[model samples]
Target: MWGKSTAAVFLGMPLSVLVVGFAALLSHDQASTTLPWLLLFFLVWIAVMTCTFLFRTGLRAWLWMGGLTIAGYAALHFLKASGLVRIAA
Candidate 1:
């Protein structure tokens, strides 16, 4: 099960990378470039998740997943504050 899940992640990360690459090429904007960076981040995440599956317990996996979530939220917050995105009242 662990092997299967890890392989799934390894395979899936490249698809995400491709999607982001296509997106970056399809759009001509600063935001588009940054969008690919987000994909790269996720690729790293998938790799981490796959690797952490080897642990006896899933503590590191949980921590890394939680940390990624927080980091994503923080990125959104900063992007909104910087006027890259608008927050609706």
Candidate 2:
């Protein structure tokens, strides 16, 4: 369905980024982060894409994934701001 496809492309992308970014933040070994995160992004993205179809409608998919992505990003931001987690540049 077109709705699922759009959700997979739009919502899934940012959600994957947030997942990988948070994971990378938690990792203390920043030296070897990039490659692993790159790999993780694909895995997370595939999972997210598949999960989108579980919703009954495209709008539902967008709402849930969007909300989830927002929540995850907020938590990630909080952790970074509180100095509980940090990503090495």
Candidate 3:
């Protein structure tokens, strides 16, 4: 119970953030399209939370989640820096 909650906080949240950030970046050109993207991200968050239980151990879950979140952020950063994706102000 506590472990699942911990995973939701430390893993699920960041994973959702990464997904939302990428979606936002991809849809930056069409700001009005954000609503659907946000909806999709919410579904993704639910899926991520459910999937966390598949790991055999809490530590493994945290490690993989943290690592993937970091990698996703890094990729987003690279894409933005390279101007492959433009963020609207």
Candidate 4:
């Protein structure tokens, strides 16, 4: 239990940030879209934390979450490089 909680704090939290950051990068930049995306961010965070306990070991959880975080950021970078997504200056 403590291990899972620790993983949630150390690994899952960063994973959720990467997830939310990727989502925001893909979302429309209008101010009207901000609230919904913020809500989605919280939901994604909770879901990631909840899923952290599914792994049999804390190490496995860390590995999976780290992989996801890397994948999310990589996809975002790819999209930006490919001109599929753009950020305002």
Top-lDDT candidate index: 2
**Against the true structure, candidate 3 has what lDDT?**
0.81
Assess the local accuracy of residue 79 in candidate 2 as a C-alpha lDDT between 0 and 100.
85
Candidate 1's C-alpha runs over 4 A off are: 1-56, 85-89
Clashes of each: 0, 0, 0, 0
The clash tally of candidate 3 reads: 0
- Look at candidate 4 and give me any clashing residue pairs: none
Would you list the rank order by lDDT, best first? 2, 3, 4, 1
For candidate 1, lDDT tens digit of each residue in 1-89?
55446544544454444445444434556453655567576766566556656645545444554455456557656765788654222
The alpha-carbon deviation from the true structure for residue 66 of candidate 3, after best TM-score superposition, in angstroms, is 0.5
- lDDT per residue (tens digit) for residues 1-89 in model 3: 56666886778978997888777767646577776777788788888998888888887888888889889989988997888887675
Q: Rate the local accuracy (lDDT) of all candidates.
A: 0.53, 0.85, 0.81, 0.77
Using lDDT as the measure, name the better of candidate 2 and candidate 3: 2
- Candidate 2 on 50-79: residue-level lDDT in tens? 988988988888888889989998998888
Candidate 4 to truth, TM: 0.74
Off by over 4 Å in 2: none
Model 3 quality (TM-score): 0.79
